[model samples]
Target: MILFGRVRMLLLRTIAYLIDSFILFILVIAGFQSFLLITGLHPFIGRHLYSISGNELHIWLFASIIIPVYMYFVTMFNTRAQATLGMRAARLQINTTGRIGIGGAMLRALIMLVPWELTHIALSYPKPFWVAHHLQSPLLYIALSLTGIYWLLPLLNLHGKSIHDFITGTIIIRWHMPPTKKP
Candidate 1:
């Protein structure tokens, strides 16, 4: 396992994140559409989702969208590959003593979801509602701040470990296999 420098790791991780985000976006859209179909809701039906005053259906729908995403990370990270699709594309792997256990993988996934979940909450509040509720500003600020810190934490460490990595005792490394000999 070859450890990457901070800059290289950052670049690779960023690209991996972009790739993962695109894939997750597609998955989320499909899941949402499926949920609508199963519930007999029209695809074109308009609903006000940009509000904190959403109904239970909205909450359930959001959970349906989120659970699969969380599972995607947890399952992928704990697998023998120890890498997501984007990570595989970038030749990066999660370095651990052995395989990262399910608990560690799940913790890492939850930690990684912090900023995203917070941002989702903050953004769900409409402008007027956010203005009326001063707490929304602080929540948004916290989400943005945490996101920046999470992304930059690796730069502060020699081993390029981020917050989630440190919390879960994992490291990201460049993975290379020896070239196969031709008979």
Candidate 2:
């Protein structure tokens, strides 16, 4: 049975996410180091190798980071576990019958990706760059707003389904153990 209330669910999910994030951070660092080694470039040498101002390079960098993460989520969600490592640690499962298809998994992964990528971009990129490039204020504002909403939406829903859950037609449910009788 599903055990956790919204608060517990949220807390568990947060813990799980932190654990997963830490793991991914390590992977990202390793990947960066590998890239540097393979290309024989100093850490600061390839400053322009993938500039944010260049569309192709920007897309490539985004894709390079996103694709592996996307595959990780999709593969885990589609597995018998039906949960990522974080979800498993939280004792949360994707409440669905049968396996979530590749398309569904991809959609869910992408939905989760948007807010994450947007917030990273908003925080990492300078405002002056956007202004100079005519990207305008609303874009950053929207990204920030959406990032806020993405987290808060779970609280608004009866079942604690976030925006991504709703968009991907997925639900998160917690596992519960039956009570034991005192001897």
Candidate 3:
């Protein structure tokens, strides 16, 4: 049956998502730092950032974003990753009626990157030229902002769907795994 009250489901789904996103953040950085270094750049924390490669940075950043999307999609679409490492840890999963799509997954990741959304103002894309000298290009911050709009799904969607999920036709459902029947 299609769901009517999406709040509970949305909360569960979001919690699961946070778990996966957190894990993906750690794993992707640990896995890809060396690759970023291969491009003759390294990630460092400081007041003044280093590197001039916007394209390289974009690529690395995209990798970081895409991993979680893929992981989330797998769980949302196939309902497997839902119970995987992150979701299991958080006790969350996909909805029975909701599902994930490739486009939706990508859209969700893209949107989540947006910053300063609570101000209810459009974010201006900063055109920092120095990034190009380091082997990078202008980033699609707007795209991320557009994608970040997904956060409003639970709030905006009476049925509990973010723009990405709405576009993908996926809904967050409170997941409860029934006991398996032994054959």
lDDT of 1 by residue, 71-149 (tens): 8899989989899888899889899999898998899999998887776566554443433463646778998899999
Number of the top-ranking candidate, with TM-score as the measure = 1
Question: Model 3, poorest ten-residue lDDT window?
Answer: 116-125
- Top candidate on lDDT is 1
Candidate 1 is scored at a TM of 0.81
For 39-146, candidate 3 gives per-residue lDDT tens digits of 756554332544424444444444554455455545454544434455565565444344444554555544443442311112111322342231222234544455
TM-score of each: 0.81, 0.74, 0.53
| lDDT agreement of model 1 with the native | 0.78
Q: Count the backbone clashes (under 3 Å) in each candidate.
A: 0, 0, 11
RMSD of each: 3.8, 4.9, 7.3
Instruction: State candidate 2's TM-score.
Output: 0.74
**Candidate 3 ranges beyond 4 A from true positions:** 1-8, 34-51, 63-76, 79-85, 88-91, 95-148, 180-183
Alpha-carbon deviation at 7 in model 1, angstroms = 0.9
lDDT of each: 0.78, 0.69, 0.49
Tally clashing residue pairs in candidate 2: 0
What C-alpha lDDT does candidate 2 achieve relative to the native structure? 0.69
